[model samples]
Target: MHLFSALAVISVTVLQAAAHGYVPLLRINGKDVPGWDISKDPYTTPQPLRVVRGTKLDSGFISDVTSPDITCSIGNQKLPPGPIQATVAAGGTVQVLWNTWPLGHFGPVLNYLAKCPSSDCSTFKGDTGAPWFKFQQDVFSNGVWASDTLARNNYTYNVRIPSNIAPGSYLLRHENLALHAASSQGGAQFYPGTFILTPVSPTTPFTELSLVCIQLTVTGGGSLNPSGLSFPGVYKATDPGILFNVYRGDAANQVIL
Candidate 1:
């Protein structure tokens, strides 16, 4: 209740807000679809229609690298998927829209896809043991961090759907790794977005990454299963990509990054 204490809380709140964000909209097939609107969804009698999976998010992430959350968003593993699913060609594109991204959060952007074995993305929760293949990534290029580009571009990025994958329901896992505070052992910040696709695509307690799930169904004649890395098992706290300091002013230190 003290003035100084209240001011300290305010400052920390702003800092955390500056550090992370979430997917609020998605562009599919040239049409824009609203993503989860955390503010209005809780009170609506019928949830908003969307392709992106429904999730309650904050400036939080899974730092343990071993938590199931690494598979999707925080606590997303337990939430039911959205009621709608978008369809696209196997080789289409989806534009992810971040609610907000601060220039201060600098790092890499990665994309992964995993197929839903049951063919029903709504019922499929790609948590532990799910095979996720890394299909796209934008790391440091031309002496600029991917996050920098994301912020510069209004926090929007386009992700290409794989053309060679089989037709089926899938989960797309999109991510952004913020290394701005990576000097310490557990200072990495990761933002992940999950999308369901017919062609495509945790545990941890650490506030290390932000993630979202998107629902998609792919329809096309293509078949090629991609070898993948499982979440939780995919990242480790000691890994150079998750723990090294980017302030040293150098290129990325690890491949997993």
Candidate 2:
């Protein structure tokens, strides 16, 4: 009886460990930023490693894409703006450090930026109406995406701020999608993200800017809907990007958009 109890405990412990991991630290231009305490509050308590099962759908994966939790997993309420965390030039790089990501979770990494109307985002309240632009995305390349690459190497993700982005105080959002179990609908695990305030210097160029959009449509279907895609609005349980098989070794089967 004792041996059986020990085995059960081991299984529970392993399951718990697999369900939790988060980005505890953030850096810009190689310098650590402040305000991680505020950013991590929505996901877990007591500062670090605050991992919850999150909102799950029928298939036991995170599927509440329309919830406010989809945006930083923090409820969409006005948060008292805190101190400015870090400042960098428009073309600088931001690095995100995760506590620990399980090797079994393999998928892509994406980053988005939303400019605040105020000069200092530290004073801006939580408003979900801000327009966000995709600044960086890592798709499957050479048999690996950002998550796969991070699993083999370091726990840090580096993102370069667009040189043409307008100088302003902005909120940066980083996301990681673990599709290891996404073969069925609603099985994709999503680590939405936390927000960080970053002020961009005006020295960089902004006039010469161009926008490009790639629309992918399945063989028999019409163009994929690209309009009205907010963080909480863009993803749905039935979207091809959310329901895919990544273990098949075929890059086409795994959509990273």
Candidate 3:
């Protein structure tokens, strides 16, 4: 017989009972689950699966369950020693790399965002169209993560930090990273990290600049107010989202602190 499981939109946390060969049907805000299938058997123990929650579906988020052995890192970069600097000049690319151990079978779900920490992001509210910068995924090679088939073997992300992204200390929030193979079990996890985009004087290309560490916060005035910035920043279901490697000159940079 085919078994089915469903969760309602009550103010309670959704939990699954321990069982074998059980399938899950995801329902969002009373509407049909756009890209989900119960018979497809997407649920997996010890694997990471992307799940959305909230009453009005206004709260968009990525929930991740930690894997037994999971890890992450940011590609090398040269950030300035200070907190603020000029934005990365126009026409520049940064390389961000991710290394997941024990490589699984399922690919990771990736998300990226850039926000300033201090004072609510209300200044440039509704300026979602700002050409702040651009980040692109480079590659997801399968060598570095061979030990863990679930891990991202090898990958590269190339992003160009646009020159118009007003000069300020920004937080590049990248999350929702799931490994393959672990998709059906219980290893869908959030690979969240922050990158500092310091806009410095474009006098000369500063290579190997030191990066300063800072906390990330986006209160958005109150609970009802949404952080006024393009969210989840950049998203990718299979490959890395944003690359943070800095080559030279003025450009956005990222580091794990």
Q: Report every candidate's CA lDDT.
A: 0.62, 0.44, 0.22
- Candidate 3 lDDT by residue in tens digits, 29-86: 2332221122232233422222210011112222321211111112101111122222
Quote the RMSD, in angstroms, for model 1. Answer: 10.8
lDDT of 2 by residue, 33-145 (tens): 53233233534543232111121111122334565555544322233334343566666776666665666566666666656566555433322553556657776777666
Model 1 TM-score?
0.78
lDDT, candidate 1, 1-257, per-residue tens: 11011101000122343346667788888888887655455357755666676554443433355666567655564455564677878889988988777786667777878888766777666765746777777777777888889988998988888888898887887777666655555333443332110110122212234456677888894888774467657666566665556777454534223
What alpha-carbon RMSD in Å does predicted model 2 have with respect to the real structure?
Answer: 16.5
lDDT at residue 190 of model 1 (Cα atoms): 41
TM-score of each: 0.78, 0.63, 0.28
- Give the 10-residue window scoring lowest on summed lDDT in candidate 2: 2-11
Ranking by lDDT: 1, 2, 3
Instruction: Report the candidate with higher TM-score, 1 versus 2.
Output: 1
- The lDDT of model 1 is 0.62
